[model samples]
Target: MDMSTEDDEDEIESAEEEKEEEKESVEAESEVIDETIILADYMRRFETRRMQELAAKKEKAEEKKKQLRYLIGVEEKRKRDVSVETIITPEDELTVSDRVSTESLVHPCLREIDISESQLKILNPYTVYRVPDDPGLSPAFWLLRERPPIYGTDGVQKFYDMVKRAGIRSIASLKDLLITDQIDLRYYGLESQVMRAICEALMDNTYVRKVDLKDNKLSADACKHLNNLLLRNSMIINLSLSGCQIGASGAEKLYNAISTNATLKTLDLSNCNIGNEGFEYIASALSNNQGLESIDLSNNNLDESCAENLRNLLSYNETLTHLNLFWNSLYSAKTWKTLIKGFEKNETLRSLNLSWNGLGVECLPYLSQLLSRSRSIDKLDLSCNRFTEKDAIRIAKALSTNNTLQELYLGNNPVKAEGALALVHAITPHVSPDNVLHLLDLENVWANKDILHELEAIKMLKPEVKVKLRGILSNYQLVGPDIKKILLKRANYEAMAPKIKRRKRNFGHFVMSLSDKMISQEKFMALIKKFKLKLSKSLINEIMLAFEGPRGTVDQGQLKSFYVKEFSEATVN
Candidate 1:
């Protein structure tokens, strides 16, 4: 009975332990379920908030797009409205002061001129713009031209009142006459009368500041009137009498007025028969003068006699920045040496034009010295002068050390391939970093392939340097298929290569007519037009020149074989 009771208690305890295990697992599973529910709810809320923010951003962007489109439409409408022209009445016509105040087109004061008494009807002053500060105002004023074009955009009507009131026709008539060197200029009746009247008109005029009477004939009486006008009008800043026969007497009168005149800044007496005496008078008058900045004495008959006066003027003159002695007779090396001395003292002169002066090998030494040492002369034009390879070498040597010269024009010289290569070597990147030469204008200097390659390499290394070559199409590369297509365009060849006289066939017949089936050099030029090649005449000539045979005739077989060989080589490559 005791054994039975013990077994029963053990079984009961086992049963209770099994029940406790089941209960603990159920509680753990319930807790996991609650955690999963809470996590799922938080994730759903986060997704909703993200979608809401994106939706709001998209709405704002759409609204901004709409506003931008509206503004663009309004701006385009405003432009269309402003572009339409409107007929203006006389009452709407702006007076001079009103125009000046509003920054509008300049017009004469209508109140001063009696519209009824005036023979002319008061047409609307070509009011170009309505806006107070339109940037197109200047272009609009330029478009309204009733008379022929003048120096700049300033119209002829602007000076009509003053010119007509002075009993002169429009100032445009005094445009292109040559003043003689004779002291008695009264015989040039029309020129003198017109010049005097214009001068008289300019005396009271306040608007005309720049007077360009270039290539015009002016008498002694006209010169006197011009002198008086210069004394009276203090606003004339630029005066050009270039290509006029203004003699020593006229130059004296003009420079005497210039000596006292304070407004003239640029004076161009180029091509004005001003000899050494005239230049001396100019130098004497301008030696103490202060207003002039640039003086052009180009094409003047100035010789070595004016060298001393030029040196004196250059030494003392502080304001003169540009001096053009182009096409003068100052070719003597002694004169150049003397001029170099003056340049050494004058630090203000920046540009000097000695082109066409025939300064040969003799003067190269002094010029090279100037290039090596001078700090002011940045531009030097020595084109059309006689310079050889040795001279070019000396100039190159000078350029190797100098840094201030920015422009050097050595065009129209015989600087061969060797000299050009020397120049390239001088300005190489490894030579000096302080080298400032940006423009080397060798416009007519001949160069070979090796020299050109060096120049191209230098240009690639320093992209700022510009080396102008001899021919425009010299360095161009031609494509084989392109040339073939141009030659094979048979339909257009009829027009390009016209039929031979008494023969209905094309240029092939013309080519066959040449002796021994070969075309001479002169006949080869006709083929350029015959080929109808859409290329520059120079380029065509260059290509044709390449096919020339030893006997000075184009080899027909070689000409035909070129494109095929080129095409084959190109394919192989």
Candidate 2:
């Protein structure tokens, strides 16, 4: 019984082990299925990630294509805009007219007309068109007759038909009316008629900014009509009465008009015989007038007193920027001094033209002082003056101190070698590598070889400074190069020679030697020839012989006789 019980326990143990083994086998199978499911899930995730990446790439490519199209569209638009603004031919310019044709009507959406292809040549865009003889007749018919088609009358007819088909009624469109010199009597000789027409045009509100009555025979009555128009007209900006016979009284009336008119900016009274009285009238207007910016009183009979009045006006007026006082005889140094004194206090005076005036050497010192003090005077014209070397030197010194003065005119001033040298020395202190004197008119200054050398030195020192030496004594016969060299060397020697040497024993002997070695007749003649003098041979020989004696042995009688004889001969000549 004990053996059978032990056998049963062993059998029970074996059955329990088999049951545990089956349970482990079932768990392993479950683990394998779980591993397969995990593998499938990983594969599906990878495929989904790849698909997302492909979709992102396609979207990016599409975006790039869209951007490229946008860029191309922008480029095309820029090209079209550029073509619209660019003027291709003479006829592509803007005209003062409004005429429509069939082609323009076809493109009804286009707001702007392209009349660039049309050929209607007209001079003077400010000219007023005369009213037609018959207002009933269409302006287009006259335009067609005046400007015929080069191809044929049939082409003109076709053009007319095109306009008619476009339903363009009353071709007298203000847009098609161009102000040409031929149509406007104002540009020609009909002064009174032009004045009347201009008045009518002003009444009709035709935009006329400028009225050029230049070189016209407009009398006081005509000017009165124009002045009345100017006083009432709001659009006119420039009134040119150049070369007219507007006397002092007329100028006074014009000045009154300018004072009252708010839109007049440029008033040209050039060559109008407006005397000091007329200038005084203008000066009175200049006190309270804020609209007048430019007044050209050139070629008038304005003297020193007139300029004084003008200067006074400038001192008070701030709006007058450009005052052209050219070709007037207000060039006395005292007068300029007074003007510059006033200018120093006035901050608005910019340009003063004193060209062709006789500002002599005596005037330079005071003028230089005045210029140095005046900070507002920027452009000063002292051209065509009788200024000497000393005068130029003083002026240059003043320029060095006057920082506001930019343009200086010294043309035709007879600035020779000495003057140029002085100017070079004076400007050396103020000039720099960057800031330099811009415009220097040294034309016809009678520059010699020495002056040229100084100019070259100035250029080397201040390479940035533009030095203009146009026509610098090109016609005058300068000293020959070799002769100039000798003369310069002699001058240097003379300068370096001892004025008072140390007193040595036998100084008297040295003086005697110098007297013996004094220049001879032959040497003096050679010097005269070297200087290129045109003295007669006989006169030269005589002068040489008379002055040839040794310093101590000079014959005063012979020298006096020769001088008297030469003087008599010169007087006769």
Candidate 3:
């Protein structure tokens, strides 16, 4: 009985131990379940916060849409009532101060005289003068009121009737009358009468100091009448005869008037079709006249001989400061050199324009040398010339030393990469950090990519220089990828590769190949020619392939044949 009891106690202890292990496992599992539930709650809160943030973003986007709609509506309303005619006001309609009387006002103030006196009286003075209603007209209108009555087609009959009623004596009273300066008689086709009236008014009024007959078809006879009027008038300082059919005879007559007119300082004979003989006459007049300061002879047929004569006049004339000889066919290099020589001694002449003269590369050096000595010339134009890279380099070198030259024009020259690089180098060093060279034009240069790289380098080295690259570049194609890759490999292996290791590799392969079998010079040359390879420098590919271990069952003949085939295929493809 005692033995049976001991076995039973032992069995009970074993059962109790098994129960305790099972209980510990259950409690651990319950703790894990509770942790999972807490994690789930945290995830739900995070999702809720994200949804609220997304709702706020939606509301903000809707508000922005409303504001955009409001702005678009306002912009559409602004475009509805605009008129082109209200944008520009005629120059002659502008008025001076209100303190000046009509009689005291200058006669040149009458730009338009077509309106009738009754119509003029009906028109508001503020509208005619372009004056605000609150400010009224300027005191210049008082000056106009004190001046002689202005006659126009609108009120000429009434003006004549009033004159007769006032017992005015002769046509002299009508002669001194001030007409509108802005006359538009195209409606009546009475250009002839307008010219006559201008001549009459200029001759009658002594205070008329300037006249502008631009865009008017004044005949040669009218020009003669105007020349006579100029002879009588001494106060006129400016004359404009642009866009007129004034031939050589008319130009000669005008030149004669300029010779005697001491007060005339400015003259414009642009687009006058003045021939060579007319230029000769004008050149002669310029030689004798010292009072004229500026002359515009653009769009005339001044050939080489006429230009030579003008150059002679320029050499002697000290008073003439501004000259425009644009659009003339004086393109000879020898003639330009002569003209530049004439300018060397000319100190008073400051601005000169010889653009559109068909200059070329041969002309640049001479001009550059001349500019080096020219201290007075501040502005020079060599635009539209057929210049090359070499010519640009020469000019850049010249400009480096020339201090007086302020503005240069090379807009249409065919300056390529070489020229741009040279110019950037030349100008970048001498320029101050604060005051770099203001203008550089590389427009239409063909090889501009290399130039752009050099420019980027210059910016990295010196950031102050301002460079301009202009013109059409839609056709500036990029280099091919295969070519770029080959160039890059060549650059790295030949320029930056490890020299000692490359030499060892080359020497080791040469020794091993020679030791294995004698390689003929003919075979080597054949291999080079087959691969289209340059052998001046060793290639890593050649070395690696030559030193590679032999393959099983591959004979030397088979290897040679394989290499020959591979090289030939590479060359052909």
Candidate 4:
């Protein structure tokens, strides 16, 4: 082959190797099991580890940049010192060295406070303090907290009047308000002319980007001020009005403001209790709004009607990418299935979270089927749902044809061994270099060792797909759907009482320790006596006949499950 073709082959191999390395890294680090745990909890661990690693990486990069800057500063200082030696006296050289100290270059943002004792006690020289104790204050709308004295919500009218009344620092201190990154005033419940006052703050100040008024119970009263803030200020992009209890009217006003403001990117109104009408208003606003990218509308008591409004919003909104509708029961059998068409049509949406919705096995086909057809979505989380073996089959079928999906999180689902086997069989044909599923997070789905073995055996088909399987309570067992029907046969034995099956039952623990396979006649008696277990030859034969896989070894999960069934609650003396 030509050099170009050889180079392309090398790149492909390198990419595959990197994918394998990541899978190995995840497998080595993650010990997620215990099938009963929530997917959110499991994912939190994953996210936490990832965040820590990212933070460390970022800190290292920053440190390196700082060192580079320090070195450059030293080199420049040395050059200046050499020039001073040639031109000035020893006293002038000392002055130059003292003036050009490296600390000055270490941080450019740090400034000194040269104000008189009359100035308020701010956190640092860089921070602006809006102290409520000013003598000339006319019913000031700020409550001072100790230690740097940051202002919380007091009232919008007072703020507006404070700005209107001239000689309040002559609007000189307002310059500091422009560049502040965080303006947090949670639970002040300030009303009346707040938006106009904030607009005044935003007129010249360009840096106060985050304004948090959480738990302030902000309503329609404050939305006018919020509307003005949006209309006037383009710098405020991230706004959190969570726990404000902003009702439908306030939401409508906020929606109107959002439609006018193009700078807002991440809007969080979570737990606002905004109902269907409020959602309708927001939907209308989002349909026209272009700059807003992420929205958190969780815990809004939203239902089918609200979901439909969101469906409409997702259909047209191109700039809005991440939509979080967690903890909302926006799905009935028909309602959710209908929404699948909307999900398929929307191409701009990247992350869709329908978690904790009780979308059962039947509902999964609609989503998986949508995945097969849609081209936009890359991350799909169907965790904390009741997934049956049929659900696994449906998802596997979708993965076989779908190409855009990169991450699939199906944790906390009851896709036991049988479902896992069927999923493995379906995914094997599609496990390839170009497979849509790069991260198959099946953590805590009750996959046993045999199920893991079956999946690992199929690595020759595609090693790029990383399957995370294990339960915290499985004692390192492979947890998966018993697709091979090896572990489920003893399920029928539960009808037989423990007393009836006591003598007839196979010694599961004994058989486990003796070669980890179907017990041979040679070691049966010795193994049984050594483990002090009661096991008859007929019982062993019966178990092998019932639950043995192709390799003549019963699945460990099956054996353990059978023992549980045969002796439902019986404990050894």
Candidate 5:
């Protein structure tokens, strides 16, 4: 039994040992299963994280591509917005040192002005002055506070940016005036504040020499500010205030400023309605001021009352070269006589524009005498006057003696072919150095083919003189259609020369009996009545004009042709 008990205990212990090992193995298997589940979960999480990283990288690449496209589009847009207008002269293309070193005929005053970049920049109307809150600022700022803004206008917000680029730009140059970098503000609708701002900006500018502010209708205050600019600035050579509404008060201010200023060369106050007193003030200032070279007082309501002031100005102002008295009312002989006396005393006047002044035949003799005596006067504009053929003849006689008159403008006058012929003869059949009449403007003058032919012959002879007949109406074309039909009617005369011989010799005698080569219009009319020709007064006048000669006479050859055709047609019928 003891042996059996011990064996049972040993079996039990062995069994217990085997049970403990199985339990331990089961726990180890459970731990392995848990660790495998955790490893699978971690592998799945790692795969998901790799996918998320790839997605993020693709998104980042797309954003970078979109940003690059946006940048390229912005670069293309900038290239289209900036376009510049460039006006380059030969002188402007040269370097400043090269320009200054040349021996050209540039004036000393013009040489003092600065050279530009040789381009025409558009005037920006939006870049306006800022109305500062402080009242103690400059006058330009003070004026801006009182003035109205360019309100309700589009693109007002872009002005500040444009103001930054407004500096260091260029403008067009006046080639004839030898003026470069012109700041043209004509019809810009600039108000007082705007004018003050522009003036302030231009005050320190040394590049611009011409400031054309025509037709702005600026007030007297604006003119005062401009006068202030003139007072301080000396680089400006030409100041055109034409068509401005500045009245007598404004004129007085400018005249007072001009009296003190000496650097300004050309002052244009035309169409300003400067009254008699205003005229006297400016004329008095110009009489003493020596720097002003040209003044245009056209359409200024100047009448006979201002003639004395003009006389004094012409007499005393020695530096004044060009005086434009166009479209005024200095019509009477007395007013012109005073002006003629002034011309007689003045020796410095080079150009005189008296167009549209209603100067009649009475003024022609005095003008003729002035042309005969004045050695300094080279250009004389007498267009739109009452100068007839007789007045033209008298002027032609004076022109033969005058050697200094280079340009004679007799446009819009009634100077006919006879007068034109007389003027051409006064010049010469050939080019002569003594007769320096280079330009003879006879626009709107009616001339027949004979006169045109003679003038062409003279042109071939005297090539130096340019006889301007632009817009010259043909005298033959001026006849009515009915008169043209009557004159152009073809008689059925088959045997032309033989029929004239059979009819005589009587037509030849009649043509000779009237006159040798030409007959007067009255004599032609008398002959038409004597021949019992059925003709109207209009026809008679047209016939005379069509067959007129250089001496205001009808051609006898045309008369003989007409009578022979008439008589031959009568016999044939």
Candidate 6:
């Protein structure tokens, strides 16, 4: 009994010892796992810290680069509080207060001149609102919800039609259709039929500001329907019936609708095959017109008689700043002369685009006279005018005297160096560091090396003059790099031009000196080696006979006779 009891107790003791060993093993393994986790966390922290340090180092390097660029006078992209043109004018210079003022130029106290949108730049004034395709994710979630887009509905016409069909007549739906670039009802139905419906519906609209019916090609009779629409829609700002086959009678009806209407701002009656009668009607409308700012009468079959009528309209009438009479040249001297007189008297007009006009050099004096007057033309486009060098010179002389003119385009003309040099020499003195002519386009004009040099000299004198000297010209030659360079420094203009001539004149003088001192072979070979001169045996004999002129070989006349063919433009072919 004792032996059995001892055996059982030993077995129990052994089991307890095994359990203690297993517990120790588990505790040791737990310690190892904990150590591993702690080491992994430390490694992750070290990697994160290293990456952050590298990022900080890169940022500091970029900052240093910017500082270096600033020190080196390199232009860097940075936010400027004010425009570059606005500078600190001296206290004595200003007749007004020295302190910075918050007065806006476009305030109510100023006289409201009807400036066109092209001349008047709205810089950074427009906003872009992005509407998401998914209506639920849109910024204006409550205001807009996705519905099946209807077949042919502008905000005004189709929305009203749809709402009426749904048996819901709401006056508030028209307010959302206020601002739109175009109510495109083109190609859905015939323009005559569609415009009848649209114009009738527009009568009920409170403020349908602008309507575009471009390329509609509706008959002249359809314009009568718009008369009621124009009379009732007093809030209409712009009306376009471009490419609609509206004749004189239709134009007369259209003009009669908005003749007294003060709210109309722009009228576009372009490409309608409007003849001389239609032009007269439109001009008559402008005579009584008060609020029209811009009008397009392009591609009309109006001749110089129409221009005379236009001059009469411009003479008596006011409140027009933009008039596009494109695709028509002044056919007569009488017409352009009248137009020039009108331009002289007119003060409100700013931009005039007389493209494709054959206003020849004969018209330049009239244009010069117009520029000499108190005309405020900021943009004048005289492209395709075939302006000659004399015409360009006249224009340049006029441009120098004129202060209000900024952008002048004399492209596609045969204006050579004489004209270009005259323009540059005249306009350079006027262009200061502060006030400048915005642009002068001489593209496709006959600009040779002399013209280019004159322009470059002008740019060096006044960096603000943006002269466009591009386009491949006809039979124009460039001055070689070895030839006499341009006179850039006007401060030393008198001192330097003579110096360059003297330097070139020395080439002939040096050859004469060599000829005097040495034999013919040694002198010829030495001259040949130095100037890389190629003289024929016959040319040498000719030079021998011509060398001993009255003034010597270096003399301007004698130099061309002896060695060098030219020292000036007079000597060269």
Which digits, one per residue and each the tens of the lDDT, describe model 3 over residues 128-243? 33443655456667766675566543333343445465554324333334343332222232254445555655554545555666766566677777778667766677888776
Off by over 4 Å in 5: 1-180, 429-433, 449-457, 470-573
The per-residue C-alpha lDDT of model 1 at residue 182 equals 13
Question: For each candidate, what TM-score against the reference?
Answer: 0.52, 0.48, 0.47, 0.50, 0.51, 0.51
The global C-alpha lDDT for each of the candidates, from Candidate 1 onward, is 0.70, 0.61, 0.61, 0.65, 0.72, 0.64
Error of 5 at 162 (Å): 16
Is candidate 4 or 5 superior in lDDT? 5
- Tens digit of lDDT per residue, candidate 5, span 183-260? 777886667665565565555556668889899998878988788878877788899989986888888777766887
Name the better of 3 and 6 by TM-score: 6
**Where is model 1 more than 4 Å wrong at Cα?**
1-190, 471-573
Better of 2 and 4 by TM-score: 4
For residue 260, give model 3's deviation from the true position in Å.
2.7
Model 2 poorest ten-residue lDDT run:
503-512
Candidate 1 per-residue lDDT over residues 1-573, each given as its tens digit: 999999999999999999999999999999999999999999999999999999999998767645643432322112213334775557656542243321122344333322222233324434422536777877778678765433322223434554666676553443321121111122333476666656654555556667777766665666777888788877678887777678887887776677778788888889888899888889987787788899999998898999999999999888888999899888888898898889889988889999999888878888888989999888999889888888889989999888888898988988787777778778877875688889888887777676766666677889999888775335567656555335433422443444454423333334333344566767766665564433445544554566667777777666555444544442233
lDDT of 6 by residue, 22-64 (tens): 9999999999999999999999999999999999999997787
Model 5 misses residue 334 by how many Å?
Answer: 1.1
Write candidate 4's Cα lDDT for 1-573 as tens digits: 699999999999999999999998887656554343567788989999999999999999767655643433322112222544476779975664455323334433211211122222323433322444668553443344333333333223334455666423233333444457777767766554544565555544556778887887875867867876687677778999888888788898887778767888989888898888888998889888989998988778787777677777877787877888877776576667667767767878887777776777556657767768878878877777778777887777777777787787777778876666666655564453356566777777665455656576556666776777665234454678643244333423432325654544444434334443554434544555565444445655665556565556445445555556655544231
> Model 6 misses residue 96 by how many Å?
93
Choose the strongest candidate by TM-score. 1
Better of 2 and 6 by TM-score: 6
Q: Where does the lowest 10-residue lDDT sum fall in candidate 5?
A: 170-179
Candidate 4 off by > 4 Å:
1-178, 186-196, 421-433, 454-465, 470-573
